[model samples]
Target chain A: MHIQVIPVEGLPIIHPGDLLTEMICERVTFEDGDILCLASSVYSKANGYIRKQDEIVASAEAVRIAQKTHEDPRFVQAILDETTDVILEDPFILSETVTGHVGVRAGVDHSNIEDGMIILLPPDPMGAAAGLQNEIARITGKEVRVIITDTCGRSFRRGQTGVAIGWSGMTAIRDFRGDHDLFGHVLEITEEAVVDEVAGFANFIMGESNNGVPAVVFRNCTRWTGHDNLHFNREEDIIRKALCKK
Target chain B: MHIQVIPVEGLPIIHPGDLLTEMICERVTFEDGDILCLASSVYSKANGYIRKQDEIVASAEAVRIAQKTHEDPRFVQAILDETTDVILEDPFILSETVTGHVGVRAGVDHSNIEDGMIILLPPDPMGAAAGLQNEIARITGKEVRVIITDTCGRSFRRGQTGVAIGWSGMTAIRDFRGDHDLFGHVLEITEEAVVDEVAGFANFIMGESNNGVPAVVFRNCTRWTGHDNLHFNREEDIIRKALCKK
Candidate 1:
């Protein structure tokens, strides 16, 4: 399969109330069967999910954690407001958002936007992706898949790679449970996280820091059948169980 | 930036003593700056890294762990032979290799090959990548970067994505430590795992189970400056620490 990955460029600095779908459509001509990946920070900025640092009043919990993290209490409060579960606190706050996605500081960002304003991950990233997909189709009369991406760190690896926080028009996983290999043996590797794989490549193209690239267009990608169970169940996640033990 | 991702197809089932560099060169015309990603299993297979299952005698520790994992003791012994440290023995075997890569079963694969044989990850993946790069350049008279990829599962996220087991001609990470974002604020996200990002996308294209495509060529990818410090130290990894505590 041959695919063309195009970064959507020439976008203005996003501000509150900006129409992101319209802006992206202006930059990219959507085609049927194209996959579009947008950074979650850009989506949050356009949707006014950013918080002003001076406006937040830190609670006692935020204040206590700030002392440990060496972060501003107001910034910590913003993270606390968005978090559903706190996994780590001292070195850096690792928390789970309401959407079943766990990330550092709940995928909060203080960079790439106006100073004094911090961007929070889309409160409803799945809905955000769906809405954006529908809006693009409405504007361009084309079917395009969407994925909202966040850069995240993983266990064992020192550097972070892009991950899909939410996706639309495709399942998060491509299940190969009954599939057989070349030798006709049942495949041992069952599920593949196809969305994260696509999102990671987009992030590689959309380098962080002044690249002006927040979205990417992947054309001619082959579609597959799968289910959308992206996040692990709390009871079944051994890593989460181990961390909570600490 | 616009990049073309092309999957090289039509290669025969690889075997021991096959010169993979020559095989891949036959299928793809190399460009000076193209990035090629090949599955490590394919590399290991061509380099005769497979082991005959019946030739192994299970050790006592392998037999003990096999009972919990419900696998052949000989298979367990093979995984143990490649593992430098056994991280988990229960539900599945999680271990670290001598190269400092943490993976499930030390990346031993029993699928896609002939029965009674198992495929192990390349013993010296970094050297394998470097040698492959040098061989390709010598054969084609074109400069090409190489990444050896392995499909592996990560913590918190369900399913698996491709990761860079070893890479050449580019740093594993793209560091943006002092780089400023759009608003001139120093970037908070410092390191990006670029090799893994490229590898993950290649794996997405190289679907498992009956898909003949294994290698992908990425053209027109922008370059970045960084270091090759991809693995975390044993003491600094909190998830490893937490797992050890359990």
Candidate 2:
């Protein structure tokens, strides 16, 4: 199967209370089986999750940690407020967000915002993705998948890659257990994170710089279906289970 | 920039001493700046790294760990032999490979091989990648990037995604730290794993099942150049540094 990533450009500066679905619809058309990858930063921006540095009142812990890491105490305080649990303390803060994503600073982003302002991850990423998926289906009358992505570093990898925080209309993990491989052996432990892979492709296209393209549409990804069997709750994520063990 | 992932089909079953580069060239054409993502299993197979279950002589440590994990002692022995350092002992065997990749079972793969036979990762992934890149350049007269990928599970993420074990002809990480975002704020911490992202996209097209497509070509990824600036030693990887801290 061939996959094509097409960036949807011409999206204006997003603001709080803007109709994100409407804005995206005006930019590009959709097709059945097309997957839309949206940057979580844009979702956070549209949902009014931006916070000013002066608005944060740093706690003693934030101040102490900031002194060591050389980061703004208020910024650290904002990250602390967004975090559900701290996974690491030194070099940089890696925390588990309220949404169950383990990443730097609870997924609190510093780029693409006004100076001294930060954007928190959307409160309900799956809900936001579902809402967008439904709106797109209603407008275009075509079934599509929506993957909400954020760029983050992994524990054993150097550079950051995009991962799916929220997804709708398709399952995140495609399990191939008991399936036959080429040699007809029952495949074991071959579950794939299809949405996350798509998110990475979108990240490559939308890019981290001032690309102005926050969304990308993937065409002809037939392996992913709109079936609910693939749908999994975030709480059931293996990463969360592994982190809990740690 | 738009990215297209086209699978190169019709490759015969690879064997030991086979010319992998020649086999690939027979199936597909190359373009300047095109990136080829190859599954590491194929590389291991062509390089004659396969070992039979009967050949493994389980050590006392392997036998003990296998009994605890309820796995075959010989298979566990193979994994132990390939491991450079054991990172995790419980739930699964997460280890640092001889090549410095930290993953499950030192990247020993069981799928796509005859029963009781396993494939070891290429001894030198970067060297193997560079060899393929040079051969492709010789054949087509086009400077193309080659990324050898393997599907592995992450610490905090569910399912598996493709990661670059070896890459040549382009930088793996794209740094945008000094670049400005849309709001003109100097972007901080925006380095991305460009080749790994391409590998993930390739994995999406090369599916884990009997897809028969081991290689995927990506066209029009202009962000990556043939310059050496993108190349960073494996020792410089942040994931390795973080794991060292633990």
Candidate 3:
């Protein structure tokens, strides 16, 4: 079966108080078991998750980091305000959010929005995903899965790829703990991050520039059962430990 | 346009001399400009990139690292042989291959093939992708893009997602440097690793276990132009520097 990846087009620029779910439902017909991926920036904007840059007072810590990053102190303050743990301050502000998703600037954005304003990642991404799923089901009467996506930089790779910050109606992972390979050998690489996989493709459809696509719908996806432990705790992540040591 | 993701299913277990391009062509009708993602393990298996475990002579360094990682010394030796530089050796042998792709265990596989043997990543992945693209075009008379994929783990995120090790007929990145967002501001997140994004969704369709799927065809994918510098250099990567310091 061929899965269809449909971009939700023709929507106006998202802003505060916009009815994002209704607008998406107007664009494409949703199907049961369909997976919908939304850019976190759009979702945040629609939900009034933006801050006026002038209102944010920079702390001494933020000012220090801003000197190293060469970013505005207020912009650095916005990142520090969203960050739970500051992992790396220089080069870029690599930090963890409240939801345990580690990203540059804690997933804060200074692009795509009005001037003098900044966009934030959905403060409660999992809750945002669940709320959207329920809202879509209520409006369309079709069960649909949702994933909130954020573009992130990888460790060894140079460029950024989309990652799932929050997901609903599916597990974050497709665990293959007892699964075997073609030769009947136990699979060494279990626990596929399927949500992130789907989100990466969704981000491809929703280009970073001014294409105006912020949401995508995927049809005919096969379902799998797994747990939702997508983020590694401080004790488990060896790379995080290494960075902390430095 | 909706992108169609088709999985190449139902082929016999690959032997050393199997004609992989022919097998895929038999299953999938050729279309112009379709992006084909092939798992690196399947490509390696068909091209005889396997080593006999018993024949491998473990170096003293391999033996010492084996005790730390709790793996057979031969497997450690296999990883070391393929590694250009060892990034980490204790938790697992995270190393960079000759093609500049850094991966855990240097992309060696001990599953799906015959017991007592291991599969190696295609020595020249860029060449492998180009050869496959050329072969497919010759046999089917239809132009197609190719990407060699490998499942890899991330630093902050748990579990593995597919990454593009090598690609043909498209840029490794979709450079949006000069593109403007909705607000007409200079784009900060410009370079999108599009090949990796496409490869990631392909991995979702190709499960890790005994589903027997190793290839995926992506139709209607929009192309972009960018440079092919996917992997980061030693001094450029802050994470690598931190790990080396440790």
Stretches of model 1 off by over 4 angstroms after superposition: none
Q: Estimate each model's TM-score.
A: 0.99, 0.90, 0.99
Tens digits of per-residue lDDT for model 3, A1-246: 689999999989989999999999999899999999999999999999999999999999999999999999999999999999999999999999999999999999989999999999998999999999999999999999999999999899989999999999999999999999998999999999999999999999998999999999999999999999999999999899999999
Better of 2 and 3 by DockQ: 3
Docking tier of model 1: it is: high
Considering lDDT, where higher is better, how would the candidates rank from best to worst?
Answer: 3, 1, 2
Rank by DockQ, highest first.
Answer: 3, 1, 2
The sequence of per-residue lDDT tens digits that candidate 1 reaches over residues B1-246 is 479999999988999999888999999999998999999989989999999999999999999999999999999999999999888898999999989999999999898789999999999999999999999989999999999999999988899999999999999999999999998998889999999999999999998887988899999998888999898868989998999889
True contacts kept of 2: 0.65
lDDT score, residue B127, model 1?
98
Predicted model with the maximum lDDT: 3
The clash number for model 3 is: 0
TM-score ranking, best first? 3, 1, 2
lDDT (Cα, tens digit) per residue for candidate 3, span B143-228: 99999999998898999999999999999999999889988999999989999999999999999988889999999989899999
> What docking grade applies to model 3?
high
Q: Each prediction's DockQ?
A: 0.89, 0.52, 0.92
The 0-to-1 C-alpha lDDT of every candidate, in the order given, reads 0.93, 0.81, 0.94
Scored against the true structure, residue A157 in model 3 reaches a CA lDDT of: 91
